[model samples]
Each structure stands twice: as structure tokens, then as C-alpha cells.
Target: MSTTYKVPIGPVHVGLKEPVTAWLELDGERIVGARVRPGAIHRGIEFMARERNPIQVIYLSERICGICSFSHVLCFIRAIEDLAGMTVPVRGQYIRTLVLELERVHSHLLWAGVACYTIGFDSAFHLGMQLRERVMDILELLTGNRVNYGVATFGGVRWDVTPELAKAMREMIRYYRREFTPFRDIVMDDPIAHARMRGVGVLTGEEAVRYSATGPTARASGLRIDLRKSSPYEAYGDIPVEPIVPQDHFGAARGDVLDRFAVRVMEVYQSLDVLEKVLDGLPEGPYAAEANLNKVLASLKKAEGTGWGIIEAPRGDDTHVVHLKGGDENVYWWKVRAPTYANAVSWPLMFRGNELADAPLIINSIDPCISCMERMMVTDGRGDPRVVTRAELLERCRRKTFDMMGRRA
Candidate 1:
């Protein structure tokens, strides 16, 4: 009989983008079992929401994930709108969709590059990064910020698609159409890439459903589920979107790392199509229902109820739940369930039978955002749960900082 050993692959591994631990039961180089431990990077974002009003929380929501910042903001705003009975203008809806697709393109390109880098395909990685800059440039031109764009507001978008901005968008669409295919082809056609990825982290369609996998993670497993396609919202209602599945492009959805990669690559093209449709169908009207912030806040003060917003974020479906108390200016409570929370559940399933070297690729196949998924929970040494007040948390942080400084000195 072979000896079995336990090895922890994270909390601070170079291969992982965020702080998450995977304790692997290894027999030689092959993984026999795995347990994922997250929460190393929890920031208590949901708890922070209680102190801020709806407007202040928008910026806080944006900070949840730099790549899909708008998704969080939109979801949070939609929840608030649901309670307030607010409706965004048609022009605003189209603009919101435009930004959403742009964000998707940005997110997919970044992930694709990182995926290449993870497998030591540095040439393709660099090219992918270079290609990504064009979309970021367009985003900056439109919103004045490349990452946490303060674009989406409660009722509608803060900025309109100016004629010049519209021209830039059209140019960007053409640029990606001409350039992106070759980059995708480079990796998809590479034999070494196939050797590294194909059949390496298999998660079946049935397994994905069982695990509640979302976004590309689920689609890669051949699940025909995309919120944009199934439950159309905003401009998606006007410009229909079909979920991209591996079986449709390839003969079969092997439900492995390669299939996940292919699904995201194909979805980039799908986003481009959506972007074009949004531009063509752009309407003329006010972007926000009420541009005045004070008035919006005042109206929200009288509303009291629980509201939920769910949207197809870059990685998967992003959900936000908010509760408001009547006559209260601050948000009573809030909860966020990011895609990584759902996709990470299947990590152990993917890890089974895979080699030690393939751990990073499989973890990354879901394009996880650890910061988005993390939630704070304090417990005593005896395992009894306890609530740490904000003051106590701050004191602990300061003490830790001082200790680190003294050690360095």
C-alpha cells in the first residue's frame, strides 16, 4: 500500500490570486481528496453596509471586485430600486447593458491571460494582456476610470454615451473582432496546452448542477443556463443572448479545464455581439430617473422591505440582498453571494484524481474572486461563535500593525 500525506496548497501560495487554502490528501503526486478553506481575506463588507446609506454603499459595492465592480453595484442598486419601485429609462438600460458587456470582455480577457500564465504559456499571456488594454482604454474614455468605474447609478447611468464615445466603442468592437480570434486560436490550437488542460479537472454536468456552479464554470460543464438568456433583464430583453456551452463549439463538453477556457473565449465574442446590439438600439432619454442624490435618498428613507437583485456577473451570477428600515437613513442589513461562493463549492470535486501540479489551473478555471466570496465570522478557541464589534476589530488590526512594525525595526 502507498503512503498518503496531507499538503496545504494555499492561504498564501504563489499560484493562487487570493488567500484560500486547499488541504490535499496526496498519494505520491496524485490528489486523493481535497478540502477548500476560505475566509483568510474576509473584510466584513456586508457588516460595513449597515453604517452607510444606499448612495454611499454604491462605492463600497464597487470595491468588492475590481473586475466586476459594476456587477456588484448594479445588483445592490437593483435591490434598492426593487424596494423603492424605481424604473430606469430605456436609454439608461441600454447604457447599463453596454457597460456590463464591456466589463465581461475585460474580465474574460484578464482571466484568459492569467490562465495562460498559470500554465507557463507566457507568450500568449502577454499577448492576451496587450489585447485587454484596448477595452480598458475604451472603458476609461467612457467612465474616466478603468477599473472601479462610477458609471452605474440607482436609477440609471451617470454618464451618457457621447457621439465621440460611441465612435470609440465602435472602433473597439472592430478592433477586438479582428484581433481576438488569433489570440484565442494560438492557445486552442496548441498541443502543449491541450496536454496540460484537456481532461485534467473534470466536473460533469450533473456534478455542476449538484454543486450549484454558476457562470462559465457551469457552462463549461454543458449546462445551458445563463441568466441573461433565460431571464432577460435590461437590454438583454431586447438583444437576446444564448448561453455559450462547450458542446456547441466542440463536439462534446468534456467538462474539463480546456472546456472552461473555450467557453469563456467564445463568450467574449458573444459579449461583442451584445455590445453592437446595444449601440444600434440605443435610445434617447434621461439616463437616471432622478439625478438629484438628496431627493433619491429622501425617497428611500420612507421605504422599508427586503429586496433582492441577481445578475450574470463576469464569473457567474452575482446576488445581493438588502433590507431597509422605515425612517432610517442607513441600510439596515445587506448580504452578497458572489459567483466564487457558488463555484468554489465544486473545487474539491474537480481536485479528485488530478495531479499536484494541476491544482492552480483547476482552482483558476472558475476565475475565483476570494475577496468577493469572503465573509467574516469570529469564534472563540472553544469553537463558540462570538460577534466582534467594529471597534474591537479595529483595535486588533492596529495592534497587529504595530507588532509587525516593531518586528521590522
Candidate 2:
């Protein structure tokens, strides 16, 4: 018998691009053990509240991640609204939900593209990206920007939807469904696809619960939990969120790559269902509250207050924690959290015993978006540095003199 050798996966390399580092103790082809460390993209945004006002905070908060920015701003505003006792108009709620769903569609589509690319399926990846362009167009038309949709305000939305605009959105979505149909088949119904994914990374329900996994990772393990249903935010509470138990769609996956693929395809349909409901229920009124930017800023002169908000980000349940203490000083403590926190914790469980080559596929299952919000280590990794991973990003990063660049090849 040959002696088992260890392998180093990251801390800087590309192809499987990510800032996350993993040390795999391998006995030949089998993983004897694995060590994970994340946190390469820490921005120290947590303490910026002491220097920024509530309005200015929105801009800073949007810096979290392009994909999760809207959710980040929405959750933060919700928390501040909770403290200020601000109630958005009925119209605002509907618009907020619409914008979020659009964001949801955008995020899922982007991931679908990335997921397809992860497995070397470029055709599916291009289709996903092509379809995502329509979603971005819708966002740009409605919110004036795509990715970081700054459409959310503390008490309401920054934009409004008209009948013509709504009709335009409907038309665009219908057209994209045509593209989604063929690609969905190519990814989901392909036998080879299942062979690669179906039972590859099997994290059972019990293990998922023990690890406190949330979002798709937990869903793949057969857990039926969605913050939209339990917490009831925006229009999701009013919209139908049927869990695709034996099927896939933001619900459960078989804890494998294919299961992850299936979840995204189904979510596309569910998101459309939500958009229809929002359009039907949207009430006519002011899109945002009349809070003066300057006055609101002045009122926020209070030295300190603590607030927190949670939203279902594209990757999973994104959460934010805020703390402030009244003082004359220019620095106040503010903390931000992302869904990557929960998903990152679940990595070790998924990686253990998995084959060496399967590491990227397994990590992609969480659709981990390590760059969202801020990266933090709940607890320190044994002796090495922390490397963040989320949303199927597996490119090993290489640090250069001027910058850390991901080498995908």
C-alpha cells in the first residue's frame, strides 16, 4: 500500500476561483480530512456607521455584493424602519416585492450561468447568461440600474411602476420563458448530468440540521424551511411558495450538483408566479415615503441605536446586524452579516470524505457568495488564514504584486 499524500487546494490559485483556502489530508484519492478558512475580503464596513448618516449608509451598504445589494439595503432599511416605526405605503410594498423578485430572477439566472460553467457546460452557461440579460434590462428600466438596484429607501421604494412599464416587464418575462424551456431541458433531463451530480455530495437531512445549514444547502437535504414563508416579508408572504418536495425549485435538492441545478430551474418558474401576483395586487399610491433626506439625516443624529434585518438573498437567507451607541465622536460600531456565514459553516460537513476532484462541485452546491456583505470567522481556523467561498465560485486565486487575481485555467 502507498502512503497517503496531502493536497493544498487554495490560499491562491485559479480555475476553481475563490479567496477561500482548503487543506485536504488525502489518503490517495480519498479525503482523510479537510480544513477550511475564509475571510479574505473583509471591508471593515461594520464600523462605518459612526461616520455615515442613514442616507449615506445606503450607499455604503450597497457595496456588500453586486448580487445581494438590494437585499442588503432592503434588510438594513427594514431594520431602521423597525426602529423608527416607519410604515411604507401600500404601493411601496408591492413595488419593493417586485424589485426583489426581479432581483431574485436575476441572481438565480446568474448562478445558473455560473453553475453550468462550473461543470464545464458552456452552452448552458451562455443560455443562462443570455436569459439573465433580459432580467437586467427589466431592472434597468424599472430601477434605473441593474445589479446594485438602489431602488430601496428606508420607508419605501425609490421608483414607481406604471401600467405601461408593468406591461413591458410582462412581455419581457414571457419572451425569456422561451429560452428557459430548452436550456432547462438540457440541464435537468440530461442523463449525463444526473450521473455527474445526483448522488455525488450526499448531505442527509440530519447532518444538514446538525450543521445549521440554511437555504438551498438545507433544502437539498430535505429540510422544508423558507424565510419568506416563515418570516413573511414583502409580497412573498402573500405570494405562493409551494415547496418542490419531490421536485426542485428553491426547495430541496438531493444534496448534489444536479439537485442544485434542479433547484435553480424550478425557482425561475416560482419567481414568475410571484411577479404575476405582485402585478395583480399592486396598489396605486406613492412609491416612497416623504421623509426628507436632510431631515432624516438630522434626526438620525442620535449617538447610538442597534438594529438588525433579515431577507432571503439569492444565495440564501441574508442577515444584517447593526449596533450604535450615542456619542459625539465620529466612529460608531456597525456590524453586517451575510448568508455566507451560515453556508460557510456547512462546508466542512459537505467536504468531508468527498473525492479530491469533487471538492469544487460540492462547494458549488451552496451557491456560496463569499463577497456579499462582509466576511467574518465565527471562530478562528486552527492555525491557517480564512478563505471565503460561496455561490459555486471555485476559482483558485493567485496573489500578484499589485492585486490578487483568480486564474481560472
Candidate 3:
């Protein structure tokens, strides 16, 4: 006779850095079924955006996900620009592309490191983070901040990359190119990594499409859909981007963890090449228009249209929709759909029929960012359940912000 039981992984787990509650149906070491519960850390960003002006909303969007902060802000700005029928200068477009690709490099490197740590390779994880610092430093130099990178605004970027900064970025790219071989060898060629990752979380191309997966997750399954390639934005139209599929380096698509890893590493190279092209063809013009906030606010108040923005974030497509009220500076309504939300449905499919030990790696392979999910649950350790109101949560967040700022000062 066979016995089956349920195992709950987390709202918190040793293997996962973020809170994702996964319920697995296990028969001994193998998993027969799986269900993931997200929304443990929702921040209600879209609702809050209705209270802020367009300028404030840009910064608000960045708080959605730290790893892909630039992607969110860019999408929000694009939506605002489209609504107002504003034109960003050619130079501004190139600058946005530069920062966007730099963020991609940083995000992928971070994911690679996390993947190593999840599989119990500490040395490789440290090395990946050490290399990632270079990208962070470049981003800090360009945007004045490393993580949030508050660069994009309504019509154009708030800051411009100087010629010297551009030179430094080129040098950084060259250094990364030279160092990539060893990094690739460690992650791709290691026998242990191959044994652990290959064929572990296989999601077929059909499954990926059905789930509406985007970014590396979809491409790893041989789906040729990249917003940069299929739906060009920013400077991507000026410099074409070719979609990188898993089969290019892996020979054939298995749609497994290994294929996702290969696709991300391959994309680092592609992003580097695209960065170089943007730099070489960068035009000369004003980086940002005049900062007349009152005028901008007046225009926004009078504007009564809906705008949609979609961009390929490091993980996948990040979309934002904005509806401007006819007589208010604040937005009437706003909605955000992150890639993780789309991929969340596909987790059960990947987790089905996989070993319990492989669960963490498979979950992380999607680059799941639960922070972007608009849900939150507060758990009290006692036997009794407690009800927390939304006002209380918002106040708690505000207090934390003040405390953080006070500490910084």
C-alpha cells in the first residue's frame, strides 16, 4: 500500500528568501501535487497611486520590486507620457535603454547567485554577488542610487549619463565579458549542477504559453516572445533586439531549470551587446524637459484618457494601466500586472512529479517576486487568529519609513 501526506513549505522557508506558502502532496520523497499561496507581502501600490500625482507615482512604482525597480518606473513613465502625448528626446531614450539593460544584468546576476545558494554552493554564490557589485556601481554612478534608481520621469529621464560615465560603462562591460567564461563554467558545466537542475522542473512550450509566461521562463521553453523584440519600446526600435532561446546553447529545449539558467546567462551577453549599440548610436540632446511641475500637474488634471504601458522586465513582462481623472492631479484608477502573477499559476505544473528536495530550485527558477503580488496576510503565532485592518497596515508602513529616514539622518 502507498501512503500520501501533505507538507507545507512556507510563508517562510529556509530555502526561500521571500515568503511563499507552498503546499505539496508528497508520497515519500516525490511530490504528486503542489499549490503555492502568494500575497503574503502585498503593499497595495496601485491603490496608493490613486492618492499621488504622476511624478510621485513614478517613485511609488519603484517600490513594487527592488530587483526590477527600473522596469516598473519605466513602465509607469511610459504610460504617463503616452497619456499626455509627450515626446522624449532621442538622448533620453538611449539613456533609458542603458539603465534598463544595466538593471537586467544586475537582476540576472542576483538570480544566478540565489540559484547557487539554493543548491548549496556558497562559493559560487559569493562570486556571483561579487561580480554583480560592478553593475550596481555603474548604476549608482549613472542614476545617483544603486537599487531603486529613480531615473525615469514623466516625459524623459531626470538625469543623463555623461561621456565619462559612458566610458566607464564600456569598461565595465568589457570586464564582464572577460569574467563571464569562468562564471558560465561554474554554473553550466559543473557536474553537480547539471545533475541537480537538468529535467527537474520541465514546463513544455505549450504549458508556458497557456500560462501566459513571459521573459526567460517563456523563452527557456522555446517561446519566441520578447517585448523588446516583438513589441519594441524606448531605444529598442533604433537598435533591434534578437530573442535568445534556450536551444541556442542547450541544443534542444527541455524546459527544465537548466534551460532557464542557460537562457538568462545568454541574455546577459545579448544585453551587453545591446548596451554597446545604444552607446555608439546615442544622440545629442536635452536629457529632460523643463521641470515645470505646476504645468505638468495642470495638464494631467485636464487629461482624461486611459494609458497602458508594458515592458519586458528582467523576470518577464511588467504592465501598468493608468486612468486619469478629468479634474484631479491624482489618478482615477491604476492597475499593475507583474510577470510573477502570471507565472504563479504555472508553479503547480512545474512542481507536479518532482522530488521534494528540488522544490526550492524549481520555485526560484521562475524568478518569482511575491513582493509584486497585491496580497498580504499577517499571521499571529498564538492559537487565536487576529484581524488587522488596512488602515493599521498603512500606518505601520508609514512609521517604518519615518524610522528609516530618521536613522539615515
Best by lDDT: 1
lDDT value for model 3:
0.87
Worst 10-residue lDDT window for candidate 1 reads 400-409
Task: Give the TM-score of each candidate.
Answer: 0.93, 0.86, 0.91
What's the true lDDT of residue 223 in model 1?
98
Colliding pairs, model 1: none
Mind giving the per-residue lDDT tens digits that candidate 2 earns over 118-184?
7778888888898888889898889888767778887788778988889988887787666788888
Number of residue pairs clashing in candidate 1, backbone atoms closer than 3 angstroms, sequence gap of 3 or more or interchain: 0
TM-score of 2: 0.86
**Alpha carbon deviation, residue 362, candidate 2 (Å):** 1.6
lDDT of 2: 0.72
Question: Which residue ranges in model 1 land beyond 4 Å of their true spot?
Answer: 381-409
The lDDT for every candidate, in the order shown, is 0.93, 0.72, 0.87
10 residues in a row with least lDDT, candidate 2: 400-409
Q: What is the lDDT of residue 71 in candidate 3?
A: 95
lDDT of 3 by residue, 237-323 (tens): 989998899777668988999899999989999999999999999899897765777887788889877788999999999998887
Tens digit per residue, CA lDDT, model 1, 343-366 = 999999999999999999999999
Q: Count the backbone clashes (under 3 Å) in each candidate.
A: 0, 35, 2
